[model samples]
Target: MSYVTKEGLGKLRKELEQLEQIERPKITQQIAEARDKGDLSENAEYDAAKEAQGMLEMRIAKLKDIISNSKVIDQSQLDTSKVAILCSVKIKNKANGQELKYTLVPDTETDLKANKISVHTPIAKGLLGKEVGETAQITLPNGNQIDFEILEISLE
Candidate 1:
């Protein structure tokens, strides 16, 4: 049920491939190397390696499930009338006049460093479905309320 852009989906697929093809073999090699040390009952190296492998396998399975359930969103067909997933929005703080840009994305694709915010976040929630020139009252995690003016919305 994750709404992701085509580019986002491709990134997910690439990460999955890297984990399966490269990471899996690397972990397997580590296991084999640990096994060469013998002493199964009290071998700390072997135990750690096994634990690491289990964690890696779990991550791989989770990634596979996410990929299987994912749906890629077509940017060209998207409605740009208001803010929504995959839309890059520019907002200005009503109080301080500070402006910021953010791309609304699925939870999995959120990267603060990249200015991509999860749709579920307070700011994104306030911006969602808001058209240009509309003001969004956002409820921060700290329970503070702030108004943001929607300046622009584009596919970017």
Candidate 2:
């Protein structure tokens, strides 16, 4: 049950198309060019090109698998009454008295720079299904306990 945004899914599809239609051809051309240089036994360029192709193919396969398993979630259908994927949550750290905001997102769409955290993360997992004004205690990777209060939840 991997969740993904419509935009994220579209991006993956576009990248897969480019890898198949553009990068694959470019790598094939490189291999052909390297092969024409002769001496396949000692052709570093050919080896490098082949390696690149393998990596590209692996990425394409992974992207295809993700796309096949992905479930696109509608933003409008998100429930604002509690924390959930695609929900923007405002929380206050009880230990430090600091307020932080984060958007719960799928692993593929999680970006720290965008303040989107993966749903599988400890903080996000603790926050999920918690309503406003409720306290959530989560264990950090360092084995420390952190308590946070849910301040708000919004689909916007």
Candidate 3:
């Protein structure tokens, strides 16, 4: 099971709708058109369409599974005293004196461009259960360690 915010669940539903309603039909049409061209043995378009259809079907299945198994988290009930999933944490890097804010979320809701990191990530894992002003030592995948001072934790 995966935890997601309401907004994340909505986005997942929208994507699933697009795939099922629009992309599925489009791929079916492509397959049908390819089949009308020539014999299946020598038709490259038919083979390519078949491959694309298989990929699309797999994606649709995965999305359905994810949506069915996902649970939306209540933002209002989230605790602001510690670093946890769905919490926006502001941290100051001890090494470079750089301050960064990241919202820790589930893997499905992770958006690096939006500064949302997965709870399973090294930084988030190290900061979990930590309160404000606590220093968390995070070890990266490359074996390098960095300490961050938690400045604030909020629901937003």
Candidate 4:
């Protein structure tokens, strides 16, 4: 089972609704239009439309499964004692002296543009359970290592 924040769960529900309400109807219309072209034996548009619809349906089913198994984590119940999921961690790169803040989140909720990294990432894994003032050495995907010093940890 995956754990997600309330906001993340809301986004997932909204996406599922859009797929069912808007995309499903749109794809159905496409299929009907392709069918009107006649000659099902040689119709390229009909074949393509059917393929697209199948792919969309698969996506919808996968999203539904994820939503059904997901659990929303309450931020208020979280402890601030150590680094963990849902914690906004502030860290300073030891070698470059650059400071970066990342909010560790579940895989489905990861948004790189928003500074939210997946909990499975190398950096997050290395920093897990680390406290403020502790240094964590992360083995990157490329096999390079970098150390980061934890500066702070907060719920938000």
After superposing candidate 1 on the true structure, give the runs of residues whose Cα lies further than 4 Å from its correct spot. none
Better of 1 and 4 by lDDT: 4
The per-model lDDT (C-alpha) reads 0.91, 0.95, 0.93, 0.94
After superposition on all C-alphas, the RMSD of every candidate to the true structure, in Å, is 1.1, 0.9, 0.8, 1.0
**lDDT per residue (tens digit) for residues 1-156 in model 2:** 577999999989999999999999999999999999999999999999999999999999999999999999999888899899999999999988999999999999889998999999999999999999999999999999999999999986
List, residue by residue over 8-59, the lDDT tens digit for candidate 3: 9899899989999999899899989988987999999889989998998998
Candidate 2 overall lDDT versus native: 0.95
- Put down candidate 1 lDDT per residue, 118-147, tens digits, no spaces: 999999999999999999999999999999
Extract clashing residue pairs from model 1.
none
Please write out the lDDT profile of model 4 over residues 91-145, one tens digit for every residue. Answer: 9999999999999999999999999999999999999999999999999999999
Which model, 1 or 2, shows the larger lDDT?
2
Output the better candidate (1/4) by TM-score.
4
- Most lDDT-accurate candidate: 2
Question: Where does the lowest 10-residue lDDT sum fall in candidate 3?
Answer: 75-84
Span of ten consecutive residues with least summed lDDT in model 1: 1-10
Candidate with the greatest TM-score versus the true structure: 3
True-structure Cα RMSD, model 2: 0.9
